[model samples]
Target: MAVIIKPFSLTVEDYLKQEEKAIDKSEWIQGKIIKMAGASANHNRLTLNLSRLLPLERGEQNYEIFVSDMRLWIEESQSYVYPDVMVIQGEPEFTDSQQMAVTNPCFIAEILSPSTAGFDKSQKFTLYRSIPQLQEYLLIDQKSYRVELYRKVGERQWLFTEFIGKDAIVELEIVNIQIAFSELYKRVKF
Candidate 1:
């Protein structure tokens, strides 16, 4: 006979309290707590490259960029996620008084991984769309020079753009920034 254990669920409050002291990060979706896996070398490199390339201040507009450590709260789905990179045009809105999780992000970028690529493109993207302040979403392929951009064109419409090859450039319309594939993939092995 095989032995099996049933999965347990945690409330939003319980999950937040536990996550505060946990060594590793985990995501809260509905009532389930999903542990986040460690990022790969290529993923880290891509994240760093993009973060450094984003200007802190473009003209009179000030922007705040956060790496992987910051948490993003999706109110519609009642979930929390840690994106690879998040860009806020102005001040960020926190979920609570603790200021641990942010609610508003104008631009978000995620480096695709073998394990989470599908989710990132589908379910995760759905949750991100619920954010009223989000304007652009970027998905970067760590294994190759490929990038996808989804820009909000209307209240319920989004424009999709894809860039391929090493010489291609990614244009972030919301922030008015452009980055070349070579620069974004710098120091990345694949």
Candidate 2:
């Protein structure tokens, strides 16, 4: 007979302590620790493009842009996730004095991979909405020239917009910036 042992769940504090010393990145969701996977070449390219473009485009705007390294704390869900790209308008709010985790992000962009696409669009998006300071959520496709935006329109309401093809431009009114698909997908071969 085959034996199946359940995995042990870690407390939020335990996870944080271990994650600090750990070499790789992992996410904590409701006491379950989920290991993050490596990004593909295309995924890395897209992430780099956005991280670079967002800062340059927002001229004179007080926005801090962080790539995949920074961790985001979702208090409502008791979860910690590292978004592909995060844009904080004005000052950023950290979860603790350690400053490893941020509590506020005005805009977040996730580059989609086949393995995480479903979660990013559904459950992840749901959790992000719980953050009061989050104004815009963006999803970029690494496999194609596609981008999805969800802007907070009202209390518990979001306006969705899609940009397709190379010519499509993603206009973020909150940040007063427009990014072309050509620029976002630059050097990213599908």
Candidate 1: tens digits of C-alpha lDDT, residues 71-157: 998999999888999999888888888888898899999999988888889978999999999999999999999999999999989
Error of 1 at 91 (Å): 0.7
- List the candidate 1 regions with Cα displacement exceeding 4 Å: 1-6
What does candidate 2's lDDT look like per residue over 1-190, in tens digits? 0112226789999999999899978888778777887788888898888888776346666888888889999999999988998988888899888889898898999988887888899978999999999999999988888999999999999999998899999998768878998888889887
TM-scores for every predicted model: 0.94, 0.92
Backbone clash count for every predicted candidate, in the order shown = 0, 0
lDDT of each: 0.88, 0.86
Query: Model 2 Cα RMSD, Å?
Result: 4.2
Query: Which residue pairs in candidate 2 have backbone atoms (N, alpha carbon, C) closer than 3 angstroms, thus clashing?
Result: none
TM-score of candidate 2 on Cα atoms, chains taken together = 0.92
lDDT over C-alpha atoms for residue 61 of model 1: 90
